[model samples]
Target: MTLKRLILSVIALAVIVFGLIVTGIWGPSGHNPAPEQQVQTTQTPPGMSRGEYVAKMSDCTACHTTEKDKPFAGGLGMPLPIGTLYSTNITPDKETGIGNYSLDDFKRVLREGVRKDGGHLYPAMPYTEYTKLSDNDIAAMYDYFMNSVQPVKQANRPNDIPALLSMRWPLAIWNWMFHEQGAYQTQQDKGAEWNRGAYLVQGSTHCGTCHTPRGVAMQTTANDETETGFLSGADLAGWHAFNISNDNANGLGDWSNDEIVQYLKTGSVAGKAQAAGPMAEAVENSFRFLTDDDLNAIAVYLRSVPAVSEGSTSRYAQGEAVAQDLQLRGLPIETTREEMPGEYLYMANCSTCHDADGSGSPDGYYPSVYHNSVVGSEKSGNLIQVVLHGVKRDTNDGEVFMPAFGQHLSDDQIATLVNFLTDTYGQGNAQVEPQDVAELRATAE
Candidate 1:
């Protein structure tokens, strides 16, 4: 063999390999094709009609629409560590919403966190998790939004993030580093129900968007089952998204499958947890409408997860019955008001519905303060907010209402009541202060 021939062959091979790598001719396995190349404009999958069910499952309206706004006419402000960011209109309005976005554009936004104009979208949209959505599901959602949803003319509100942080270009870098772009793959060993649950929770539904804890950069710590924080819970806005993990103490350990199903379906489960704040909105707009089978699947998947404990007693263990007779009479004498204001306030305002012993109404409509997830949570935000704003849920049985005390009670009074409720019926002292109540009240206003 001639040395010249061997050298020429090696040079040719190196040039071919370099070209392949530069042009991405030999890409890694499982790489999603470019949005333009992957467009699917055909009709939705069989049996999927308007994609309304998928929208309901995803809880689209929860963050997109305000109480006074039309559905999908996004203006809801989501408060983050950096600033308040308003959701964009997703209705089919071309001027203000996504009416002009093609299926490819929509898929790009969901899968790559990039917009029609190639602008990067903030992670606040939960596209990190939505990246796992199947093409069929994304098509259905696109069809529903474009064809079924009503278009609104409302313009998007500008985000309140500071000048430096408001820049969208950095998000592209962030997505490149942290986001996983592809369709969800099923686990070979898990059952169909488990996989379905995983698809719903991890993909379209994106439950971990709120439940999972975030890192210092305000990015979610984990999005899948591989991370311990998956569904383990975190603080959102001012409300504590209590752990949904199977941990006996901190999570849903004591909850039966039926109880979890009931809670998701009805937004409340007798003496156990009742959805409130953001959770209540999710249930009202989304979970309540989910099929029974999906709800059961969620329960099953949650049960299978390993528990993440926070070293607290289970909800079942914390609620000790208080003596009825110990309930305070009329407001305490002025001399002792400073010392036992909570007792006096509870007796006057709360006990009428909650009962003197903190045991709620017999039908569990009022919900016992004891064994109540809000009261027992390590954070007292939900309890304080509920007191200030009240709670209302309409179910098959009837509408349940807790009157708002913010108008009547001073910040001190609400703080006092929260402390009393937590101390009596909960595990740890709420440690809520009047200033905290004042802050929450101001935000609500």
Candidate 2:
């Protein structure tokens, strides 16, 4: 044989080997589930309502529903580094949705990130954490999707990613590197309540997907409470998911277990905190509907999460009322409004609802900015986001509405107002500039 022929053969072999290593073409995938789980999938759960409850526990509506009229006909645009990925239609429509997916197929999709057609779904579905759901829960969820949900006929949209990047094969490599597929294993040392809470937070809720920091690959840096980074708080996409762990100042360390329960149940805890953004949505759709036992369990588990202090400042301890009202009162006799724009903005726009002292109204319907987690946090992103976007959270009680000033106020004006809030009622650490407001405003847009 010629030397050139042998050299070409070796080159081809090297390329093939490289491809195999990178893509893990030979590796096992979403088809695998434990023997017991497989058997449990076949059996009927005690009640159909449990299925709906499980669906809510998974917070399926948050990602899968965009329009109010069309729930679970998923078309939410999830932003990726290279491109945008649109969620698939999960409604039970035969033509465009998962109408034909069998129980086993649903199980594979939920736990393994494999679609019914044997294609890989991006980790945006949170299958890595969904893998921890019990077999009964998976079965119940399947039942809910199949029988309870009203099927919508919307066609699935193609992702905006590039052709080569869109190939499913590369995901095999990603899965091998990042995915941890399995069901929850109960801790013998912990009580039933703690275990239940752990299962809910780590499994269905997938709290780490937001609260935990991510690696370069966008996989959560930590999967469970055993890791210090798990739920340690992450600031991303212009919003900060504050630490839900037991760290003081930054986290819930100073919060009583009952306070945690109240926060989850109502989306507000008077002077302490109030939910806004995605968290407000979570409260409106999922957490507020949780059963008392489950709420208590979650509180118990969060209380037990080891303290992970990020800084010396106790966020809740910072700031006092700076008498902005007095400044506003003397405004006519003193310098022009241009001199104190921050104070002026607060008094004119905010004081009616939030009060001159930044203290909430009598009924606690409007929450205080002072001694509040959102305003006092080190990052100040949430406060900025709230000011730009406004707050609208609804529960069985009623709706809490704060109108958006994004259109009315300029970037500099928004920054001025937020800096005033932080200085007068919060830590005064957030010396927000107009650029900060502009950047975060762009993301929201």
Candidate 3:
């Protein structure tokens, strides 16, 4: 090979690589819909009037509006890698909202992640999930936004990302790699209930947002049961989103379908896992409103899912060993009156505010330990902090805060109270230790 020929070969290889990268054919495509293509209204169903129900299922209002504003007028701002992205106003205001959007235009955006003007929507909208909705669902959603939602005149703020991050063309390429660009297909072999559940979880509700694992690109690795890892639990903002698959280890393989339905309907579905963080939002705003049929369908679908074998073992699996070690370490297994200084400690410090039942104010002021799920999780870190360093609950109508108790309660007392709460209300997981309290306090500090 001559030196000139080698140089030409290198140049050709570089050009080929660049071409593949630019064209987005180097990897699986992401969900990227052109704005104009997405907003086309010609595909709307002949007649659909149940738009309100569809809108509720979609939970558009939760992300689209801030607490103080009109629903879907678009003021919620979500954090992104580069910068924050504000929600867009979806009201039918001709000037600042979707008033100009025809049914086809609305359909295009929701169905394809494209706007009427031919711009691509950011993935933050969960279009990757929404694209799986049936065309009927898309039409119903369009009607709901158009006719049912109240219109407010509001302008969408420009994205906070720099030009490099905000560039839509690159996202178009990214979408080409990852986005699934069609409505969900009902499995021919599945029952109607299972299909309904699958559609709900995979499409409008996007259960995978919390359950699915993510790749380096920050998108859910895969959206359905065909992927063994789907719903196999992944770490979220700060906490772990528990696996929802039928895996016997970390997932819900042990939970009965009824328990799942009950948990979804109410915040408390004892002995099983409870909702918290963003999941709390999902429960309060969305799941709580689902029809009994829908809830059952969800349960049925989840139960029918084939279980996956998880290589990552759960800490609870080694409970017997952990318990023996705790005893060896002189961690008290039984709470004598002397060891349980928390009883007196609670009377002196917390009785006035929290009450003897461990139930705080019922008006949703202070969290009630009698019913609070946080005190009941396997991990007591959050509960220890709540007792040691009190927290202020975010109230809608007023300002109220839980005072910090670290100044008053010793590590032992904090541990005892947490243990009491866990034994009383929490599931029968392992007991917490004073060392655990100290570690949690230090971390919070």
Candidate 4:
């Protein structure tokens, strides 16, 4: 054969091989559970089952349920830069949800990102991370959703992404480029606790879905411990998912293992930081219910994470007490001297709960603004969101609630309040613009 013909033949062969690999038509096959391993009909109800605990670990309700909808009935709108993609109903509604799915069908969706009818699921489901979940966990979850969840007749909301971006065919290519199929492999060198933590964080919990930054095409920059940006931080919706890394300044470097455990279990750590927005939801719905051993394992794994600095002061360094001044009270005498709108706003609206000195209750039930992770962080998104949406945490301890100020406070007022809080209690010069506030409000809505 001619040299050119031979080269052409080799190129064609290579292309065919690449195609097979990408489509999973070749290469090592994925795990296929035996028929007997399928979900049993007489399993525990989802509400009180071990599978319920597994679902909480997955935090399924956070995405699948909307504010007004029944849990797992879906319709939660996930706003993306491209467009809005509503979450699918995972409830066992045969027509609108996964009710008709068999064990293999559910497994395929979770591990391969394919639906019961052979449709591609968007990456928003975090199947990339779910793919790593163990077969047992998958079976348990299947049982819970299928047997326990009440089916709602609500139809799935259609995504508003542009046609070019919404097509499922391209996702096949995207999956090939970004996804890794299979269950999580336990690292031989790591202890059992660390391995378990790694599985929970990387597989079931999918913590990196929010905490890790995204690259082009909006895929998480890191999926596991190997990448530099893993759990470094990411902006989600209107909130900033703070760096959970060990960076002494911008990350959790100064957080003790116990502190991490406390934060996960209770969503607050006295003067350090309190969970808000998505993190708060996770705590309320998922983490708070986890076993002490599981929480400790997570803490150990997180504490071992390498730090990724972003040139900011540590939470330890930033929590110095601010001097109490009458000016912070918006008293007539103090208000007449300076035209600080933010100070007045804070005094009038925030001081009663956060305190005039910006120190929360002495017990840390109301976390002090000073040394607070949200306030101290470089990103002002969470601070802005907390002000607009307010804060609420309910646990075994008690309920902590803050009323939403978005309806009452103007963009200018919020900007003023945020700027004042950051300058006074946190790292100064974290200026927030009125326009920024307006945008955040819209996003939150």
lDDT of each: 0.77, 0.80, 0.65, 0.78
Error of 4 at 332 (Å): 4.0
How high is each candidate's TM-score?
A: 0.85, 0.89, 0.69, 0.87
The 10-residue segment with the lowest total lDDT in model 1: 36-45
**Candidate 3 residue runs with Cα over 4 Å from true position:** 1-49, 306-445
Question: Whose lDDT is higher: candidate 1's or candidate 4's?
Answer: 4
Superposed Cα deviation of residue 6, candidate 4 (Å): 37
Sorted on TM-score, best first, the list reads: 2, 4, 1, 3
lDDT of candidate 2 over 65-181, digit per residue (tens):
999899999999988865789998899999999999999899888888889999998998989888888888888788889998899999988899867567776565567657877
Prediction 3 TM-score vs. true = 0.69
Task: Go through the candidates in order and give the clash count of each.
Answer: 0, 0, 23, 0
Which of the two candidates, 1 or 3, achieves a greater lDDT against the reference?
1
Model 2 stretches astray by more than 4 angstroms: 1-48, 333-336
Off by over 4 Å in 4: 1-48, 67-69, 328-338
**Model 2, 197: alpha-carbon shift in Å?**
0.6
Question: Which of candidates 1 and 3 is the stronger one according to TM-score?
Answer: 1
List, residue by residue over 1-445, the lDDT tens digit for candidate 1: 2446534644564566557768877443335744443222222234557377777778878778775448889988877656788999999999999998999999889888888988898888888888877787788889999998889899999988877557676565456446778877767688878877777788877889989998755678877777777888887777778788888878887789899889888888876788777787788777877777778778878877678888866654566668543644453467346667767777678888888888878988778888787887777888899999898776656666889899999998888889888888887667888999988887773
TM-score of 1: 0.85
Tens digit per residue, CA lDDT, model 3, 1-445 = 3446544644565566578888876854434433332221222223534566567667777688775448888977777766778889988888889988987787668766788888888888888888776666677777777777788987888878766456565556547556777767667687778788888888777888877888755778978878767877776544456667886655667667888887776644533334555565676667766777787888888875566665444322321101212222343434424554545455556657655555555653444554443654565655676677565423223333567788887787787777766665455564878898787666541
